[model samples]
Target: MAFWRSTSLFSSSTPSTTTINDNTINQETIERLCDRLQLATRIEDRRDALRDLKGYSKKCKLEVGTKSMILLADILQGDRTDLDLIQLALETLSNIMTYEVDNNDEQPNLPQDITIQFTELFIKNKEHVHAALDLIEETDFNIRRTSIKFLTILLTNCTKTLQDIILESGPMGVSKLVDLLQDEREVIRNDALLLLQILTRSNANIQKIVAFENGFERLFEILISEGGSDGGVIVEDCLSVLLNLLKNNPSNQSYFRESSFIRRLVDCFALNSIGEKHWLKQKETNINLFLQVIRILVSPTNSNQNIVACQRSISQCGKKKIES
Candidate 1:
């Protein structure tokens, strides 16, 4: 969702305060956009309506809350091939349904209760969530990226409900998200990584599904490619997803150990050009997460064999570090 930045996706249709008098969106304008969306038969007209709706949504999200979700979902479900229309609709929905609500008494865009109600409506109707999920499969970059962003927001709103929906989407369900991890596009890969971290936390069934998709192999591969601790923020995100997959999930821990991915995990600690004194914030964070992953594998509660295997891996990593 990249904070629902309209400029990034639609530079031409960026929201302008001048379009809405006094930086306020009137109800009349809102209804007109809805009418254009419903009655317009031409593809261009519908696109224009959605674009305008997206602009208005940015102007005042509370005014657009829940009121336009049905129409937006309809566009998502009814028109899959129209990339422009879908991207606009998704961006509009993202703006309208953000966790960032303004509680200011003078100009409250969305109240807490309204936010809950909006989330509940989307959750109660599984179709809306599924529609967004299907869009992730689209080849169009903006459509796929926007849909992923929208789902991230939804998941953040109500984790349990969203997690259940994604899990019920069958084996291919989690696979779609997992596939994004390998996408050549770094931003898309990073977005997918963040979503996976949230989605897999404390959810053993989903974790198993992810692991089956060769999750550990792909993630570690990315870690090594990114230069491990020396890599940018993407490295930390990758580690976070790995942590979520293994944390408190004994089945996943055993699977990780059995898969013989420990060697790959140790490789992350290999020394890089940046020494400890020159380690930046992200590098420090990444090293801490790597340490956390090591701690999890070697914890006492784990079977002695697993702990010993992890210890051996650590000793090997240390020896490599010393010999270098």
Candidate 2:
């Protein structure tokens, strides 16, 4: 028996019932499967079907290639779909991309084609941004988290469209991205930070958005308030964003200098006597960032008192060069 026949069909116990084959999964069957996936009461069932479809893609089962890609793209384009399903679709697509990379396969790069289609869909569909925002607020933390990851991937791959979406979404979208900094999941937080970092780099207008929104303050708060957490991933991410923002807007160096952000970063170095685990590793990052911020502040062009304060803070923190 073929792989699709072995895995795609479900045998019914009733003698009158029949197993459905891959060939039978025509356009209508694809539509019905998509409908069931969208409306399924049980997450497990949806997940199982998602897994099967992803597996089918991996095995180069092109029988349902166009249909599966279209269905998955539809899910990606849906108005109020379950975030878990969205994430599953995204991950499945990502896995397909990875398989394509590893196997040097070119035929079933349907996901990439779908990505282009979804880029257009997201651009033309007014509901796209709202759906993404809703997914960010999903009750399931993992779903919420993965959606951000997918969004970042989408944004990275489809920069022009994502930038347009961000511009249209405006301060509200910026605020939503800021709120994710406090998310319990570090990956989501990091991705949000990264998006902000990317957006700030895209245009000087975004600098005004960041400054007007007190974005600098929020970044500092995350670094100072949460740096001591489990692995300091939050602190590292926050610091990276801060560094990028500062690099982009040299004027904002004053904000970091005045807001006690420098001191807090220095404190990370001072307090991180712990051995080299995740948190300590992150501590080293904070220290390096602290030094870089100091370097920026103390440049002859920026001879503010804040520069002196930063030097003093680093001195007090003790000299510890970040290992390359």
Candidate 3:
């Protein structure tokens, strides 16, 4: 959580010199920790090994660029049997990443060093080389949930480079990332949507690719199923991601104009107003996102059919209004 605040200096034209120091790394201790982490038979033993390493790195304030961080990421890929192992791996990776780029500013793009490090490690692990694809398919819900955090750390901080990784993994990985939007785990779904928001807003390349894969259609499905439910923080995020995907993204405009999103937009208003006024405040925010989406989807130069459709949709949102 703290890592997202620390903006990666690499995102700018003039990247700052990495603050990660490497000279004092006690190579023997790191090797010993890695060996024990891989070989320990007992769950506590394994977790302790990871803990020691976490402390080791933190004390040294290692940059995520080190092979030690890469090793921790490797621990994440296996068909892990121990929940503790998986959790330790997850936390260890989280700690290393935060040490590398922990900022309080809440910036989005990850530094180039951190991005390249994960990419290289993910490439080497090969167990889940396809990334979110295999990880999302894990039978363990906890594992799946942890994957959400790990993947978020990777993509949110680095836009284009990470997008290139998914694109190279082909449509399956990309589709898996989208499928995450509908995950039964609310946090997973929210994280997936957040990642998609980054892709659509900052990475135009992924936006067009997502359009081809029926991403907008799938997102609309999320709206229809989860709209106006006060389940979690996902409602506004879901709506916001769809808005970003369709905003100025001309390729998706056709689908949005013809989409049940129009109807859904109208329904969100219904859900927010008198019919479901109990959720008025939260649902109203969703309605605002919907309205902005409508404005973007219907351009004067694009199609009057869509414009007229949007006009009808806006009117439908007010249909629930009562007369004195």
lDDT of each: 0.79, 0.59, 0.61
lDDT of 1 by residue, 134-167 (tens): 8998878888888899898888888889999988
Give each model's clash number.
1, 0, 5
lDDT of 2 by residue, 20-110 (tens): 3433444355456556665677878877777666655544434334345545656666624566668777665544333245564333323
Judge candidate 3 at residue 75 and give its lDDT: 59
Candidate 1 global TM-score: 0.85
Candidate 2 lowest-lDDT run of ten:
1-10
**Residue 91 of model 1: what lDDT?**
83
Q: Highest TM-score: give the candidate number.
A: 1
Which residue segments of model 1 deviate by more than 4 Å?
Answer: 1-25, 99-109, 272-276, 316-324
The reply for model 3, stretches above 4 Å from the true place, is 1-31, 38-47, 55-59, 63-67, 77-86, 99-129, 208-232, 271-284, 300-324
Q: Each candidate's TM vs. the true structure?
A: 0.85, 0.61, 0.68
The lDDT of model 3 is 0.61
Candidate number of the best lDDT? 1
> In terms of lDDT, which candidate is stronger, 1 or 3?
1
